[model samples]
Target: MSVTPEAAARLRAYLAYFRDLGVHEFYRWSEPAAQALEPAAAVEAPAPSIAAATGVLPPATPPVVAPPLEIDDRELQPAHMLPPSLREPPAPALRSFDDLVPLPATTIPAADRPAALKVIQDEIGDCTRCPLAYGGRRKIVFADGDPNTELMFIGEGPGADEDAQGLPFVGKAGQLLNNMINAMGLKREQVYIANIVKCRPPANRTPEYVEASTCSQFLIKQIDVVQPKVIVALGSTAATYLLGRKQALAGLRGSFHSARGAKVAVTYHPAFLLREPRMKGEAWKDLQMVMRELGLKPPVKQ
Candidate 1:
């Protein structure tokens, strides 16, 4: 049953009117209608939400972390951990006898005696024990001769001749000493000659105790260095210093005394003999004693 051409046209017009009123498809033109409707459907869908408009929440925040506590490796003990005795103060340091008082300028050991003599010589340059150190153009009156000689001659101090020449016993007294040494059949070089004090005393006044004390260590060091077999203490000062006595020279002389483990013979100083020439014989007798102690024969008179 085909419809007439006019009926077909009338049916097509009804279908198109139905599509315009929101009918999705009319069977006769459904394929073309679907193609046209697709574009409008795609355009009507709401756009995907924008990230900023949606108010997206941030990823969960990590929790706050506390700092690690530091630990000391050492073990802590209580105050009572140490023994009571350990808490007490340390004992005081021990001191020697010499520490109680100041020692002398020259306190050299016996082994170092020679070195000490050199030190003293270097220190006391042109020294005048009293006023002689400054009196004139004086070089230091250093003691000379063998430091280890067996016989030692001790005088009071340097004199005018000794001060000028820088050698001991250089004046008239020195000539007498030379003659005395010759009388013993020995040269001055064979023995050692020194003074109680190295420098000369002013106006040849006797040395005071302070002066003697100041120079005593040097003399002692010399004796210790020489270890002499016989020591001749020439004058009162020498005798007194060596013997530690203030006895009269008349009594102290003509006798031998043990001085620092050596035989010390006392005699009148050559200067004294110069003043009192009458005592020359006595001085000669004293020299005999010195020679006798040393086991040397007296010289024969020519």
Candidate 2:
């Protein structure tokens, strides 16, 4: 019959989060007609109605009586209150990159890789295959750097700079990535660069599951063509999609994993290292492991 002001505010915030995730429908949880509340408590402290509380229209069906719940407005837990359809679903088991499809019996020739990649890009032309296409992305930030390089770097997705330039790793993070590349005794032009998702997510937030899964097909093709000796996954998202498994960056890092015939190494993203400078040393260790695998020596100082 009534919701407290504090409870109403919490509900509004929770509903806003769900709405951003594209969950627009909701059902109001109310008591049955048989268990009417006393008039005195209802009148003494009237608050917002259920529909007003969540900013959603009440269901057309008559309110069905559910068992009474004693919820604390201070620490609102609305998921249980929402219907099963509206509740956040459990994370599904992600299919690994190798599992997506069998590797081609033969690799594309180095001379034809650029053309082959172009074909994949052409296939993805003016793509609306995912929600990111309509999310104000200026351009699809596709793969960059040498197509025949022995090494590759895959990041989460484009940011403002990459979105604007239509190239991956072209921002402050990109600058730092260039520095990392130089430190690895390689020029930026000598290795490939790409992302798990080609488009910049709104507000640069991590791409949602649908967005990432939808965009992964192109990335898988890119990796298959490049056939890099080693791939440096620039963050957990990159690692997750490339390896086709969801695990902590800590567990995924410090070891080599294989995907599409490339040895994968997980590390912190340049953007993350910029935020937590202390982690630079740890990231360097991960890179060193890659350098060892690639037989690469750090560039000597002048």
Candidate 3:
């Protein structure tokens, strides 16, 4: 019988799943297959070869898996053949997960968070800390959402909708962000939101380095108060300031960097996403990493 393409895909998918589970050796497949593609690549492009999809080659070192319990497959199963408990799968051996994720957010008492955040806002009142303050903006867009959240999003600066509303992330890009958060099984209010510069930069250009640097202290203070477990730096400007240096978005993305005692994941800004929708998948992958740390499950596919 001819192997259907669908069957081939399912088989390869199973292989990849097993490979990650530490099952590298499959009699019918080899390691060359899994080497054809990388998980991070899968986010950027179409799926690769089946061999790559299904990791067939076992690791050079035996993976840390459940103890190898020998089981006889000589005959059909029967209750009389083996105890029910014996048929159970073994627990996986412990593996070093030390660097896999950041420590979970230290829980801040809800009652104290508001008062603490208020202190920062009060200090920022009628701010003219930088040239950004003269950018024809009527109000300062400080932030939005909960101060007690374990997740926070820091964007480059406010846009028209945000500046007019005196709130961060209330524009078309904000809508996209809302969808992104919903995909991660979270709400706009569940996570705190802020910006590198409280005032909108002229014509929505990148916040100038000096403006970003001047206002970053307040942003840093806000982060210190919230102490979110993870902070998503939207776009390169946000990343540069949060990470304390200039870096290509590509270079800065795809991993967690420690910033202000929190884990940070850098990705394209929502405004950029609106312009280049194809990159949304890549952005989604970044968010998934944050979700994993927060133990959040994505919304079910329709």
Q: What TM-score, to 2 decimals, does candidate 1 have?
A: 0.58
Q: Encode model 1's per-residue lDDT on 10-66: one tens digit a residue.
A: 555655655665565535446654453333223465665575468884676764333
Off by over 4 Å in 1: 1-116, 125-137, 300-302
Superposed Cα deviation of residue 249, candidate 2 (Å): 1.3
Compute the lDDT of residue 242 as modeled in candidate 1: 74
Range of the 10 consecutive residues with the lowest summed lDDT in candidate 1: 94-103
TM-score of each: 0.58, 0.73, 0.63
| Cα lDDT for residue 39, candidate 3 | 28
Query: Which portions of model 2 show Cα errors greater than 4 Å?
Result: 1-89
**In model 3, which regions exceed 4 Å deviation?**
1-108
Better of 1 and 2 by lDDT: 2
C-alpha local distance difference test of each model? 0.69, 0.86, 0.78
Q: lDDT score, residue 120, model 1?
A: 70
Worst 10 residues of 2 by lDDT: 33-42
The count of residue-pair clashes in candidate 2 stands at 1
Model 2 over residues 183-224: C-alpha lDDT tens digits?
Answer: 989999999999999998999999999999999899889989
